[model samples]
Target chain A: MPVEGYAGDGHFRQTYNDIHILCQETAKRIKTEFNPDLMIAIGGGGFIPARIIRTFLKVSDSPESKPRNIPIQAIGLSLYEALPDTSEEVVGKEVIRTQWLDFSTLGDKNTKYGGLLGKRILVVDEVDDSRATLSYALQELQIDVEKQLKELKVSEEERSRIREATKFGIFVVHNKLKPKAGEISKDVAYFSGTDIEDLWVDYPWEMPDILKHDELKRQDDEMAVKAK
Target chain B: MPVEGYAGDGHFRQTYNDIHILCQETAKRIKTEFNPDLMIAIGGGGFIPARIIRTFLKVSDSPESKPRNIPIQAIGLSLYEALPDTSEEVVGKEVIRTQWLDFSTLGDKNTKYGGLLGKRILVVDEVDDSRATLSYALQELQIDVEKQLKELKVSEEERSRIREATKFGIFVVHNKLKPKAGEISKDVAYFSGTDIEDLWVDYPWEMPDILKHDELKRQDDEMAVKAK
Candidate 1:
């Protein structure tokens, strides 16, 4: 049952078809489920799924109206600590930020969610394993919103008006059912396309040998059909 | 031959396989040809291809070293103008920037680009139709580099040192052979996966009906084989 190179029952390499279908199906429910105005994608992993789901999130006011895509703000996070030189080193499990939201253009008064202050924002990622990255992103975003509110120096009532409108939600293609290393706020709306086992997920993008990876996926599908 | 819904001889729909192969093939050349240190992905369209290409570009220092991804900075641009209300409106062909580089987090002294001052940077996008967006991006980036140098008050010799090392390049999946609306700097290196005719390319992400879109692609490939 083991594929060459990737030898283990714990590894599950997925094909593009399944990921595409999952996004499409999830978008159908996400339409009414979250109905988010903005998306904060944890970069690299979240980029593809965010772009795919944006196709479904588009809305046109009328027959002639242009269907607009929901804006995506990419935030890059890595579980591993990158060394100064290109040498092998895995020192700690700390999260390092490579990128964050561009606040200048995004913070204009005319623009929606000025500095991500008050709007329905959805944080998207490929998978939720330790829940460390998601928790960090949400907490940082909350801090950003709070800081912006104070800096702008708006009236207390005016501040409360935006505060009530502001909300955060989460969407992931796969959420591994395991003991999470981090915690998430219960108040934030959560949606996962599929609940997966606490195993090693070999995403299509990370496959060094895609052909072999896909072949294994095909065989798995065939075995599943035969078993049924 | 024309297909239902998307009826036209000019509109060509691509399957995921073709796109994936194109990225793989292009990455092979990009490794030696461009040898870029960083990537600037034009969001949405560029997001998918950039992620795919990054998979191939990674290089580990040693047997135990982790193959690090060439960091991708996303910039968002759109051809259409967005209105306050969700109403139909076709504005000029001007490119509106939705997102730009995050100067704060990315401008660290130890960072690779050092505010993109002196580095081999590759700007990636899905297609090159009008050549307007790509041109604008390069020019703006040059301006940003100049502004940073001035603000930092870098010495003349030091400025020249980084400036000589600094270079810009481009990579796109499809480049339509047509008279471009905008012009690019001749000195800047350019790379396109494939040169396509002036046809409407329906990318995998834009397919509203993916099943039908893929079926049409299969039929097209079969016809090509039969003709051969």
Candidate 2:
């Protein structure tokens, strides 16, 4: 069975501690499983977690090697073509508002991977929902590396580093419930801090919504009394 | 003696560990001084550091109290009216790109502080340079809270809670060197993980430009060889 999504009854409220610990664990997994030198974080979702994971990677680094100085690149990906007005419009839809592989929004306009010729790379995000986002990211990276190799003339050693560099995906939560189209390539591995069911995962970042909902309810009650 | 800018010989590079440590210390400062129930991260700069500090607050909370369940809100602010064409465009001028207080870019559409009547709030970000961004954030937050309190109808206790709630500022790096306009009210304390002499602090998040520079130099060398 493909390790995709999971089903569950109740929602999972991930606390700050939960996320911090998961990032630590994810860093550990990356060290042993991937040992990546570059971490590419998908913006918004992956940005915060990726930073935490990078910090954790320092502690997880081997005693001998200078702590892995894994440089991070942030890329923005949005499935929506336009912002959906209604909840119904967003349900079960993947209307891409922004391109999945936009280079313009790449967090750093500088490096452009000229220094990453032979580095193992890790692409990270908060969740792997339909798996499409991660899939697109992996494919684009492969295409980018291939293009760079063909265009740049470098020593055989540098060329080999570019050719042999590996890429993988990391997520804080991997939803094993929603069935996605395809898996990340066999050669490219994926790691998650935690596996969660398809139910809603309430993150600390979204607490404002919960607070706002309560406020609206109180206002509605007061208005109803006035109407009566 | 206004803290406006720092003159220095070399660039100050801030490593991942430096940031992580600073965030931890900022959390400690917040515990003793502000004890805020909410954290608002100024986007781009404040997002990551704010989140890390928020996490640290959980650990810093007193043993008897439920870990400070402080909620976070993210708002984006850009000083540039237009992006500079070359790196030189941004050196000396404090360009105004976006509105001083862009609430539209606030991460959540739901709350908008409908429930913030009595809650203590903290505005967080990476740096407090020139202090314009932090100054604007403090003023806007004061205005928003005042507006919400006047318009919304809630219990006397809730109203009191809202009125008593205070706002503070937190930063990973507070460059007291670059002077700006008015300060945040003395009642609303500001906390920083560390302070540095006014100098160019190169963050890991901004590593791309450095990498890009190396790439450009290599390309230039190759071109020179061809010309020869």
Candidate 3:
């Protein structure tokens, strides 16, 4: 529960309030800069922040009417095996699932409610560790988006144009400063709430004894203050 | 965003800390009473608590091994016209999705991970206002579970046995104590974190101004104290 191997009060901890603020602050930039149409949250860890940030991402053209919530799709990702940095992803099929994802609910092109055709998609998670999971998500999403384009009976030029317009962005509460196992290209609009040295930071959700976790976190705060 | 027409400063606000504790406490009972295999979260509102509760519901077979996090399926649900108390629901297809849920990922009966065949299922949401959404979700899920049973070419007795074993439970953070628009049968094990009068309650996730919301919540606390 408290991150497998390191299962005690020895790890760095964060309060629920801090994480909520991080998501809120980052979402301000995402609304104006990225302007995503939909979001795909990597399950479990990403679920909390993805829902939190959506409150800020809501769009209301006119104040009189209700603000529209950005629809979010939560998906699962598991690493097959460590691959070479240059090699293409195996594209894990067990989780991505061709039965759905841009085929049924998300793929219905005509419906104003559905369709990922040329819409901007934001991929969210709690942290960017090795980035193996993030890389897998981005790769599979790119394939799915292209498949949606291919199904459409349109000219090659138009298909390419729509493909280009269908942008992808990455957002995570914490982006670790370390060599990643997977690589992300510069084309995607990447946004991170904050960057920190690679450290074991326990999310509030993972802590079974939250009060004690907060007490330890407070001690850390005191140490930093004393050092200063 | 703040529960439609009942917006602005006129709302009962809850802090993030309070909600987290509510979920953790409710989860303790859910763990003993109705141990769920997989969760189906009524999306947007349900997403937050569903994720939070999963953290506590996790099972660690051994201390050395990591605790298994319950997989969650976030789904969309919208009402199709207000039906009479006894009238049947016009099952909304734009959202229910036949392609997924107990069909693809959840339906693969052979895989230990997938099947909804005879597993305990938990349907989660933040608030149960009219019970329309929860009723809709339970009906669709019941239909889907039966469909899974029908697909298998088994004897009638065996099918009935499997159906009986499949249990369904409901969990919500807040339950408004009033006559609901939709009806829920007595069989389903229901759990709500707290019950309040039929008033507009503002969840932290929906707030645009969280600080102000918390401050108001603090005032409510003070008022409650003074009244006592």
Candidate 4:
């Protein structure tokens, strides 16, 4: 995530506070709405709120902060995971592991369970950087990844491969970093590219399971095509 | 801001299409990088990309079809103004004279030239019924005002005031809707709340002088604060 520097202005503080409030609201909503079995938070700087919410859950007595049955897992895709550690007491129960996997380190073949395989994983990283890495990683994991890669402006060869792999259920985070002209694709889950503070509520999490199942089917169809 | 139901197993097209690709990219960096800009966008939703960026300038191209400039006039206590008629031809600018006003509307007293003031704006129809109305009207306006309102969670009192107002500036169109949270405070040009999507980039033509001055002043003071 990019940080804007504004001399002595309280912009940073205001921004942080805004993000914190959003985090609290999101936590509250999750508690009220679809109480998922797991919250797989992807991306790096975006992980701050997840960490804060985790801390709040551990300490706050608010009704909204009551103990949760589901685990909130923070996954960092880069070379390192920078979020604070989970409370030892909550480990394995409330909060799960904060694992950092270097996809670059993983060779073509799968190494272990931790290695990307059929596991339903969410890739969260800056769109540009993540696009390249996600495409490559999913391909190596033998999972189909789907994305236009037009924003990344990659070559046709790369685009074709990504399309082929995406047939295996890989998805991308959609939203804009700045305002521009064009229609937003209705195919994928998108959050506002400009707004990072409302990640909890604004980002679409209500994706239907049928879509995932359909994506899997697409992958199967593609594989069958290749076989033919 | 039309919400189209996709039947392709949930996987549709890219949300940011091609025209607003830069906006999406810039927003990502804004949230991640420390780049400087007077205004910023923060939030997530289907319509965020165009709403946030279009508030800055108009782009004329495919997908975005009618692109026009929407300049920023001022940022003050929960209020922002996109100068009237600032948007260009491609985007077909239409002023949505809303029937709602809130505490943010009070700040409209600052609009000296022909701008929003003391307008009988419509507060959202009662929350329950209002959702449908907002959805309908917002769709007509081509902006998801309801989604933005939901994300904003404006207080009833504020909503009543905005609704009772006599005049106001409204922007509407119909492509993608970008709903956001936070407001520019009424007193200073300070932004409160979380997830701001900087809209200054879109309206390159009508950058508010006051905002520039305030920003510079804020920067100087911040320097002093940091030095202390």
Candidate 5:
């Protein structure tokens, strides 16, 4: 499934330590499964992923011990013409390169193959844009949808829908800024942007669901009444 | 002279930004008279001096450009045995090395030269340690006392006292656990540490002495009567 949402909220909004922990987990996963020649990260905010990868490299003790040769590279991809005025210094210091690719450049020729063809690409965004302008571009590049779906853990139903909708392509629509009808493909999955405030609120509740169980609730209520 | 105290409130302690402003102002006065090759920063928090130096580098546009140098070397002298556990990552990333030197290391003839000897040191601390063990160590290093005094903007009377005291040789009392007692020496000059609550209380009254001559007090009396 295409994960989309604000990273600062809910399950995504993570602390530096938390990001480090996730990196450790990812490093373990990579060690177990595929050791692709190169790991390509595509996103604007490159610090988090790059730091994670760096930390992983620091901690991981692969028998090969060839970290210097098999490097994890990150390339920033953005839709806007101008670079976003964010923490560029921090990002520049961390990432290899910042690439700007305009989706409009893909036109009818197909976008998938234009940049990310056979490369194992990791697509990151606040939300999944159904326009598929970026994803379609990748698909045209001869990227196998089945492989990507399996890797990303997308449900079989979602994979079937994506394969079926490959013909017409996709379009972009904004809930707040409504687009014309048929502008976007309905078959593609959409993820709501994660907001920081919402993440702050949801993080505590995301703890084991047992905290919300009837027994816990009754005990909490009894304690409160007794204290009162 | 060593300066200390919290800013705004005890809860919201003063930071490097606050100290940098004052350091810059002091730098302006002595910039022409004594061009410093190195700045020896003594106790505050490690971050504050690091920031002050960083800020200085930002504004400094001299031919030497002291700030941009890779090993922007400086010692962070403190009475504390260990440097406070802060995100030292800031120093490493910025490529600025703020080396920590314990005050206890001073006065041992066998010890290598550590404290500011001939360098135009900027001492930042809450209070002066009259016992002078640390100061004597620096003096033994053949540091130009006259030059240091001038850089510190010491008054003539203070200069004489420091010169005479140094002749006899001074020593700093070892009091890591408890606060030490001692007024600033003649060689030292004071910088006011930020106290926001005090500023809030004193600012209005600090207006022109001429304005305080008559009308303001009458207005205060009338206001007091109205409250009654």
Candidate 6:
């Protein structure tokens, strides 16, 4: 069973409160450090956190300022399979595989109207496990921006603005860095809420079956304690 | 060409500020009236409004209150083509053809445990035109709940609770009612931000081309006023 290797002994368990505080702090840090013009959230896991961040970034509460409405972009990217862990395997072994289900361009009108060009962008996700997903997302974003620039018939000034835009990566949790060769590029700045050792982290939003297993285990633990 | 018939003449032109106020007001109304256990937002259009509503309905600001972390669901229902005006005819004719490209079941853990079984649900969208989309969505929700009940082997008490749950529809703009026979059931209550004529409403999130058309028309209107 996948739960057999549960590292519950001293693993850093995070509750919803922990994640929420982290998001608030991360938003503040990003505002001071990066001051990004656009935020791209990796969907599914990143959706809720990204929304919170956008809310904090709102300048005004009024509706007339349509431009002040939260200007975040969402992209769906799924890139992991439950293959056997092979840290000790030979270099030739398949360690991880990726899947890109939907790669639609940014649909937000603000993003289309020269928002992404020549501005700082922050890509947010819940976790940076193995960094494979984030890496692929950043590369794809570069391609998307370049494609948009080619299609847009804009002035030379606008072209320069689009060309000079920078990108950054952010996460709620960052496992202790082992620093694999050429996995994440050095040019992209990275931000994270908390750092931890290499252990399986059980998030609250896991599938129903896994959640049921977790509940059962908790009940069993409580029963054993009472018996003792 | 679609902008030719824009309801700018004596039309209820809404700025971002106006929409924001309406969303807050609508959120308050839903709270006092229905007090829904869950909010299912129609993606793209309903996303921002739903988020605002969820924030207003927050039970607490703490992170530990997992239940209050906006227990909302997203359904991607795209049934429109072209720019704006066709929403009455071509879009209206095909509004019933809802493609659930991402019909993810409600994942809020509380909803899974008991909330959804016998709870009030609010389905939110930006506009209710001809009532086709909202009607189809309500029908689909009924089907989804029934299917869930069938799959889960619950006791008779739980089954009854699930059956007793109700639904409500909400929109930012409700077009003038030209009620068709049995289109929107009388049983289902609906709330709206405002009501306007059957003329096409131009939203701020329009595409660049449509926005440009609006801007050019505004310029021409100003030029005519200056000449007069």
> What are the per-candidate TM-scores when only chain A is compared?
0.86, 0.69, 0.82, 0.32, 0.35, 0.65
Count of backbone clashes, every candidate in sequence = 0, 36, 1, 89, 23, 7
lDDT of 6 by residue, B1-228 (tens): 122223346343443333455666676787787777667666546654565455455444356533343345555454543322222322354542222322333333345544245557777777766666676777777776677677668897777666765455555444554453226666666788776566555443332233354465566456546655
On DockQ, the candidate that comes out on top is 1
The candidate scoring highest on lDDT is 1
lDDT of 4: 0.28
Candidate 2's C-alpha runs over 4 A off are A1-9, A59-69, A80-116, A154-161, A209-228, B1-45, B49-124, B129-228
Evaluated against the true structure, the overall lDDT of model 5 is 0.31
Per-residue lDDT of candidate 2, residues B1-228 (tens digit): 311222232355554445666676666778777777666666546657765565566422456545433445555455532331111113334533221222333223224344444556678767766676676677777787677677767777776665775455555444545565536677777777667666556554444343453344445445546655
DockQ in order: 0.41, 0.04, 0.29, 0.01, 0.02, 0.03
Enumerate residue pairs that collide in model 3: B102-B107
lDDT of 5 by residue, B1-228 (tens): 111332222222222122334445544443444444333332222223322332332323466543331011213233322222221111112121113332232222321232233333443332222323234324432354455456555578866655554321111111122232322345543333332221112111111231342244445445546655
Residue B113 local lDDT, model 2: 48
Summarize candidate 3's per-residue lDDT along B78-168 as a digit string, tens digits. Answer: 4422221111123332324312342555644333324677788899888887788888788888887787788878889988888888889
**Once superposed on the true structure, which residue ranges of model 3 sit more than 4 Å away at CA?**
A1-10, A62-65, A79-102, A107-114, B1-10, B60-66, B79-102, B107-114
The CAPRI class of candidate 2 is incorrect
Per-residue lDDT of model 1, residues A1-228, tens digit only: 323223346676677666777788888888787787788888778888898888778766579977777788888877744642221113236777878887875755434448887777889888888888888889999998898888767789988888777889888988888788777888788988788776677777766677788898877767666655
In model 1, which residue pairs have backbone atoms overlapping below 3 Å?
none
Q: Give the DockQ of candidate 6.
A: 0.03
State the TM-score of the second chain for every model: 0.86, 0.68, 0.83, 0.22, 0.35, 0.70
- The sequence of per-residue lDDT tens digits that candidate 4 reaches over residues A100-209 is 33333222332221223222233323232213333333343343123223433667886565443332222222222333222223332232223422112221111123
Write model 1 residue lDDT over B1-228, tens digit each, in one string. 323223345677776666777888898888887778788988878888888888888766579977777777889876644642211112237787888988765655444447887778899888888888888899999998888777666678987777777789999988878788778998688988888776778787767678788888877767666655
